[model samples]
Target: MAEADAFIFAALQQSGMLEASFQGSSWSVSALTSDAFIAIVFQFLTQLQTSDDNVTFTLPSTLTNTPVGVAARHRVGSKLANILKELGYAGDCGYNHFLYPSEKETRNILSCFLSPQAAEAEDDKFAIIQPQSFLANTLPDVPLSLESVSPGIAGGDVTSGDIIMESVGSSGVATKNVAGEENFMQTQLSEETEEQALEQVQKQVDDTEHRIAAMRKVLDRERGELQQVEQHVLETQTTGQEMQKQLARQKQLITMLPQAQANIAKLESIFQKNAEKKAEIAQQMESARDPLLKEYAQLESQKSNRKARCRQLIREMKTFRSDMLELTGVIHSKMESVRALERIHERQLAKLDKKKDCQDEGPMTRNMYTARIMDIIKQVHKQKQDITKILDDIKGLQKQMNVASEKLKRTEAVAEDKLYTAASKSKTSNSGKSEAYVECYRKFAQVRELFEELIVLVGDVGKKENIARDLQNWISQLEARDSSSHLDKVLADLESVRHENGTLQNELRACSA
Candidate 1:
């Protein structure tokens, strides 16, 4: 663990992420707070985005050159996470870790930038950090031809030692400077991230298992081919021995020597062809076996990755399970409180029954009552205002959640497209047809998601269809029932209206006269 810490600390220093004042012994994951972590990531990723065209980031609107609020900080963190994901960062890059960094998660994240090789390299020894760590040993093979004029100053054991010692010095600086309380940083993944990570790890395990199986299959095929070749060679040897015996028996004949010579020549030609076929088989075996071996090696490396991930997940699960146990304890305590409150309520009821109070338990003056009433009214108004403000905040948060969810979805889609799909040009210009192929991986993923959504929607649709049919049938029955009664009532009302109109007109005429 110390070695790992040393490695991580050394890397941070080498990459200039950690300052010169930061010492290796003092360096720990606690120093990276939510804001601090986001700032560092933003700085690194912004620089990365500038250098690489492929690396794009979706900046939070509220984020200025300096981010202020927690939400803005989180958005910035998520942006960094998206960028890291797009860049194919291996371990957990979720914003939760940025908000609450763990030693393992922080180290994994730092390694992404300082030692990209850490992911693909078969061993830590093969990482770039290892080379720099052993600069004293490796510098001897270096030629000072570029600085031939000042070879003495340009390259030597002293310079190499300094180069090695510099890392040591940076790590030392980190030790003295990196002081922070360990309690502040939650040294595990958060609750939401845990499920995502478990799924991701399961997928990786399945992939590695599948790859290892395929490699084994290729090796088996190679072994079978090799066995067949050996059997064929054995048969050839037996046939040649028989032919030799036949030629030896016919040696008395004058034509036998020529015949033997002819047989020998034919045998030589056969051997030559056999040799060529053997060479071809060997080449084929070499080609096939090498890739399988490489794949096996890669899988072996991934085995370590999967192990580390599994351990991390186990740790996260353990922490969460403990929290769950604590929650149960809290729930039991609350139940006890509820029972106590019930007893207290019963005692209060008994007291109320025993103690009879006088009617005038209030202030003597009406002015006092008025003042009290006004105070109550003011307090009610204040409470109402507070409620409204709280509701407004809730609405704002809901909007933010919706917007962030949509943004993350769109960003992931674009990131996937950028990371995986390369635009291919047709080989019709003299190259090749570029393999007749159809890749609908992304499309299929979308369709799968659509079908899953449709599954839920179809049930709702069926229910709605039944409801509509019932409503339509009910409405049709209503329309078929009461029309004649309604028409008779309407005719009676029209007759009454005509009589009233005639009376009103005659009254008007008499008034005019």
Candidate 2:
């Protein structure tokens, strides 16, 4: 029975499926059971098969005939089917009593346990199985122990001591197999974990490099901006220096402003003094003009009075000339009467001579003739006395008219000379005064012309002795012209008569003195 047990254990270990199931649990002796172990081994192998193939396991004939062995096999097969289903294998139990729908392989399972070293040497043969696909089923193959193999089964001589030594050796080999399998699993897990850690470190390195590059670009951009700011600061410094120079120039101008203002004040003072001087001169001129104006008015009044006196004297002279003409006519008639009286006296004398020749006649006739002659002589003497008185009265009136005309002429000449001198003085003094002064000068010139005309006419009157006859001729000429044309002639004749009367009066005054 021990031999049988040894054979079964060796057979289970030799199968690739059983080795993987044992390695999955790290070869823990407590988890291993006869039925569960058989199920895991069969399920693993069945999953390795292709869909169109079938996997077969032939049991010992003695075990298959027993009820307990048959029941155990059935239960193990059911468990195997359940494991195969969990591993994603598709198949059903067949009438030939083997798992169906599996892949085909020619390798013997017993060789994996018999020569574990040989299996390692052929590791390339199963290298296609990925760690993630069969990790739960994978395990290291362990060499079978010599003690676990009965000599009778192997056909070799054996003894009690050999058995004891072999047993010890077998136990040590199993311990070594469990430790080797654990070490192999740890090596795979460590390799996978190292690869993942390397990948994470590489990813971190890439991210850090990218971040550094971005920071460098930002630094370059900020450096460029800082350079521009520095240039602006340099330009501002230059502008500030120029502004300081301008401020100095402006300060110099500010220093001169007070002197300029003082000069302006001095000029303003001079202008004000000049204006005051102009006002003073105007006032003095106005004061000097007042007396000249008064004198001019007085002279004008005197000229008007002189003109009126001259007109009145002309009228008186015209009346005196008419009276002188009437006196001359009466004197001529008186002279004719005196001549007729003398002729009558001569006739009477002749008659008296004839009467003396008859003297011898009577004495009474002689006395009557003497008395008549005496009466006629007395009447003739009275007539002569009356004629002499009339002649003396005519001579006295002519002398008085001549004296009045001479006085009037002399006064007119003095008034005219005074007016001419006044006009000349006003023309010189008031030349720039006003328009009225110019008008006064023109009036003075007209008066001068009238004075000249009167002087000529009065000189002619003085040369004429028959003043009445000359006046009569002038009147006759005036009457011959029209009234309108004779107005100027009449005025001229009146002015001549006035001048003649003025000359006569002046002469009379000279003689009387």
Candidate 3:
């Protein structure tokens, strides 16, 4: 169990979840009781895109021992537990898995989460934070260091560049002094230490400046609106002031109203007269249009008839064109067939002409043919006699050649036996002998011993047969043993490879963060 705690602690440290100044022995003794754990959870939630905006950054009991503190801890724990389970964490996963887990359980959980695949996933998830870090790092230098940070915030701190969010106690409870004007380090500036107060001050200044500029523009816009409203009011008053003058003009218009009415009456009379004239003219125009209307109807009918005739002609032309295309195709095929048949006919005629030429009147008669047949028959009989005589001579020569070959073989065997008989040479080889001759002599010596032994074995058939059988049995045993040993060697190699692979895996696990 202690080993497991050590392992987990080492892993946490390697993953940069703890500050460099932390020197506690056990996680529960130092990290778990401080704001560090909550900070870590906050980081995890942010990486996962979870809502951790309400997570308090103080220790559980630092706020209060009341139900409020308990509930806050529970909320944070449950959120982290859900994320862990979604990451495929098994076992009794709950709020307690993070806050009340055993050392062994913690080890198991971290082991699963720190796998190579999970590392890659974490890398991608954390990639979105790189730009902020870059900006923070490139910020102007500030006079800050770890020495300036409070002891509580410095203990087990992971990073210097991070957002500044401090949870405060508003009620009767008192939150821990984890961050303050000069105690905390944040990502708004790359420093060994920073304070949340500085970030708030800068943000407040920026917001005030922005608000001031916007308010100024709003003021200008309001001024313009005020001026327009004032001009509209003046125009309204001027029009109101001219109401009496408008009344006098109205009285004058009242006097002229009678004259205008008379004119209106007169125009009405003229309008009535013109209306009657218009009606008469309309009657005249309508009567004139009747004949034109009839003629237009007749023309339209003629146009429709022509259109129908054209449609019929187009259809007939289409049908005739299709027929022509089909007829052309048939003619082309017939022509091709005829040309082929003509070629065949020409070939047949040529063959017949050749036959007639060959059968033309012969130069010799039947008696000439008979004489030729007798001559061929006599010649064939003479050739038969000559062939039989040549065969007899060939047989005699073959028998003589066979006898001579047998005699030569016997003499050569006697000479070879004598030449290769076992004997010893002088201690020193003859200096006059060439290298090839010396090599030949050495071979002759080995061959002589083998030949004598062969002769003896041939004379003793049983001994020769026993030697051959022993040799075959020995070869079979050697083959069987070789196969077994080869298989054993392959198995040994495989076992060695497996051992090496296991060792390499263990080393990799030990080395990885």
Candidate 4:
């Protein structure tokens, strides 16, 4: 029974709610209290984030017969100080304040404290006071009853003490009073320590100032080098832009070169046709000459015969002259075609010149200028889309118009054949029949007029298509030239600038070092 009772008591002790004490109380002076204090301090230090805050201390009579014990108070102050330190305050007094209130209070009880001099230098300056609540002194303990106490402002029934707040103050060194040789020695030692610290700080400040001056000199040198590099880049950019302009001009010429060759071919074709017409005219002239010469021989044989032959030859000669005149007109038309082609070539050259002038205005690599060019490219692209849509719409309309015109042409052709057959038949019939034929012819005229109108409209549409095609071709050629030459030049210029920038960076680093 004795062994069983001992085991039961050990089990109760292990359960931890009950404890073995030296006397009447059940509470044991185990490591748990110290552990609890450490845990509290750890939690407060880890979790606290405040400049000013209140800490509540509960005097738990159940946890101890000695509620206001020195160890307990010390633990409480240490926890509070740890919490304040974690909150970035400068309270230096540790757990000493709780054990000796007067000494701790005079020495500054805060682990995190701030002074007025420090406050003025800060941007968000404000003061705060943390109040400590002693709950056991404010509340009554019931007779022979053990109640667990926890501290807070809310529970007035258990609170036993008034919350005390302290004033804000600064912490610094206190002057020592010298009387004996020991005191004098202590004072001299303290002064020597402070002087040494001040001298070390001064030395650090001087070294820092020297380093700053050296860095400044280096930066100035780098700045000068950068300026020189910038000038070089500017020159490179200018040269690149000039090259780009030439390239653009060449590109424009490239686009028009084929068209120029086509124009020459067209002129040659016209000239060939004219030559064939001239050759045929010459052959006819030669043939006419032979006939006239034969007539001349006949005139010699007989005078009357010669007169008749001569008159016939003269009439044929006149007809030949008329044919020559027609040939001359055809030759003139061919010459005009050649002139038109030459004019077109001249206009293309002029456009190339204009492009060159525009491209040569300045260095294309300027950041602002390149940005503007990009903006222009965007605008051009947008315009191209709009133009393409317009062209598509025009093409759609032209297709419909062509269909309508072809239908009108077929209808007009059928009407004309019917009118021609009816006219011939009406010519052999009576007056009434002739009048009917006239009415039919009038309707045919109206149909012909409608067909003519449709043709005119279709012709107008064709002209518009021609104009649009020409404009689109020009824009495409210009944009292609701009992109290949201008954009490439800009990119080259950018690369040069980037190289210069790298050089400048190296110089800056060297200067810094």
Candidate 5:
């Protein structure tokens, strides 16, 4: 019996419902009174029954003369009745005696605890029990009873003094029993302890309610934050879709880059060929200009020399004509003088003939007259010869002057023809050179334009290559992150972009054509 009490006490202590103390070769629990202990046991049994209907825990069969044991059993019966009522089991649950009945009396006692209606209900419906309610019921108050005194002992015959002693002793014994029972049911019997316990229980209940309310508030706040996060995710998805479209267009441009590069290379080759032809033509023009310039310089020098020589010849001819005129004037004057002399001599001769006929003079006078006359005749003849010679010389000089003037005119005409031919040849060569230079300039302009276009295209190609490199690095990073499935989708997108680029290229070719 002591072992059984000790086991129950230990179990209560372990559950934190009782505090044990050593007292004179025995252990006492002060945290729970007998009634509260019984209530705790009943609650534990109720939980066990609800948890598993097939299992049952039997209480110990020990009985004691102490009021605590009896009060405990009565408290258990009351708790069982309350449980049955809460479970909706109708009908009365019988007396406390059935709580620890003997094995032989178990069947009969079980019927006393469970009414027919309760037994029937127990098979189908089970009640949910709350932990707060269990805690409240586990320590219920129990009233002490003094009605179990034996009537036969009270009626026993005795003397006056003996009766007085017996009365004193009985009063003392009752006081002792009450004090012992008070210790076992402290929280229920004492007003101050019961109030303190109630206050403590109320405080615990209040604290639990506050904690639960705080948890609920936290949960609501978290729910609102989660909703906001969901909205942000939706917006992000929309922006990502727009970015994907832009990327698709960029990919298409990248796909056409190689073909554009090939076309640029072909154009550059043609430009190179044109440049080579221009250079060759320029060299040929330079080579051809050398001899033509030399010949032109020589012709210019010859023309200047001829002009100077013709001018000098003209001055010399004019001087000679002036000299000849002066000489002819002197000759004419001399002839006039000679003519006078001849006339004088003829008159004289006439006079002499007349004298000779008139008188025959002496031989000496006749010879003197004849001699003077002959001398005069000779002088007149010489003067005539001199005048004729002078006239002849003047005629010869005039003829020479005419010949020289004619030669000068012919030389000037020939020189003018040579100059004209040289000028015509120089003009033809200049025209050819100008045509070649014009053609070269046109070709150079075309080549310069092509080069500028190529530079632009190359810049565009470089930009595309940089984009492609960035994309490759991005794909590599995704692969490193173990997103190969997404890589496959990206590759498919690339192929589609390439196809679109090919179509665009075809359209461009048609437009250019």
Candidate 6:
């Protein structure tokens, strides 16, 4: 739009009906004959006011500085004023003329010349310059001050029929080349700054990419290591659990060993007591008389009954053999079952590790992995339950074995007690003490034989019982007593004859008395 205005003003300047020039490089003017000029200037000013015409003319901010835009402004404004006047009103065009392009001058002229109130101020009649545009007829009492221009310039007091043209001149030479070079330099600096900024941005991008790659590698390494660690942990856990179970079983056996040793010790002590009692009874039998011998025969019969009880212990030992075999087999099965559970636990732990590895890889839906872990957890729980059940079974079998063993032990103990009781009595009794001691020793020998049978019957594979061998010397004593008892029987028969002779003598004595 500014360009179009430039063209129009250029055309008007070229039209030779008016002369145009700039004054002091700030104000501009044009002039023509007054007859047609004043009416045309009035019409143009009114049109400019009504149209609200505006032009932005670039100039150096300081009035003394010359710019191309200022030259163009002067030329265009001068041409516009000249064109206005040639089309006719009441004035020529110049800076101080009534028809000049001063906005204040034009407005005041319209107020004074076209107002009816101005006719009332007969003194203001001289300010009437022309019949003009429609807005000129609606003039108010307001006045335009021309003080900022040269005094008395373009005022309501003016009546202009003659054309006037005046100008203030400038002689400084204009230069466009220097300004063009400065603009080019600024553009180059802007382009260089832009290139530097782009390079910096690219460098930042490269650094960011390298950091991202490093982070990704670190994450991948950690993830792989974590997976391996998880697997190792699971394997270790499985091995640890198996070891713990084996240790527990070993501990249980260790606990039983001492008790077994205690039982062996107790049985040995009883055997020794029996042997000592048998020896004492032998001494007692040596000094006894014929009446005591008859009493000793009765004691001998009781010792025979004790010998039969020892034989019964042997029979009971035979019956326990099958039960012991079953117990050993059950123990083996339980161990196997425990081992199988351990294997399953290991497998489940392995699967859980795989699931965890998969989960760590990326934004995977852990649902399947989690579900698998849960399944493995449940399996582990079930394995724990199975292990517990197996342990319970082991406990039950152990209890059964202990009960059977205790029964055999108690039976053996009873037989031992009987032998010892008979032997102790033989030591205290004078009558038939030798016969009774021999018989009691025989019973102890039988009982020891039965215990030996029990050891063989219930023997664990690859195991031996140094059978309670303290009773061995006692057996020798019993054999010796058998021979002694035979001698004692003959002695008693001899003594009985002697006693018969004595009894007859006693009867004669009693009669004599």
lDDT of 1 at 373: 62
Taking all chains together, the TM-score of candidate 5 against the true structure is 0.23
Each prediction's TM-score versus the true structure: 0.25, 0.24, 0.22, 0.21, 0.23, 0.24
lDDT of 4 by residue, 1-513 (tens): 344333333433442323334123232222224334333334333323232256433222233332366667665666565655554555554665443444234223211222322344353432232222222334234211224444343366533322211111111112222246668899999999999999999999999999999999999999999999999999999999999999999998788777997867877999999999999999999989998999998866675564355445434434543553454355445444544654575477558646754776654445645676676677568656855765675566556545654554555555556556656767777546777767867865875576458547755765775687579668757865765545665676677678767998999999999
Scored by Cα lDDT, where does model 1 land?
A: 0.62
Candidate 3 has which clashing residue pairs, if any?
19-156, 19-157, 161-187, 162-187, 184-194
Worst 10 residues of 1 by lDDT: 418-427
lDDT of 5 by residue, 39-89 (tens): 444545554566667654443334222235566657556655565455444
Candidate 3 residue-wise lDDT, 310-367, digit = tens: 4454344345435534543554455445446544654665575456435633443445
Model 1 lDDT tens row, 226-248:
99999999999999999998887
User: Which 10-residue window of candidate 3 scores lowest in summed lDDT?
Assistant: 163-172
Point out the higher-scoring one by lDDT: 2 or 5: 5
- Model 4 regions more than 4 Å off: 1-374, 428-431, 442-513
Q: Which stretches of candidate 3 lie over 4 Å from their true place?
A: 1-268, 280-284, 287-295, 325-329, 332-336, 342-513
lDDT of 2 by residue, 1-513 (tens): 344334435545554445454544244323445444444444445434532255343223333222245565665556544644454444443211222212121012222223443455479667877754453354222123444766685575665446545776899999999999999999999999999999999999999999999999999999999999999999999999999999999997787688998867977999999999999999999999999999999998987787566556545544544554455455445544544554454456545534543452332232344454565566557556755665576567557656655764565555556545555666677765435545654664575466558657745654563475568557756764656743664466556666666998999999999
What lDDT score goes with residue 161 in model 6?
A: 17
- Model 3 RMSD, rounded to 1 decimal: 49.9
What is the model-wide C-alpha lDDT for candidate 2? 0.57
User: Which is better, 1 or 2, measured by lDDT?
Assistant: 1
Give the higher-lDDT candidate: 1 or 3. 1
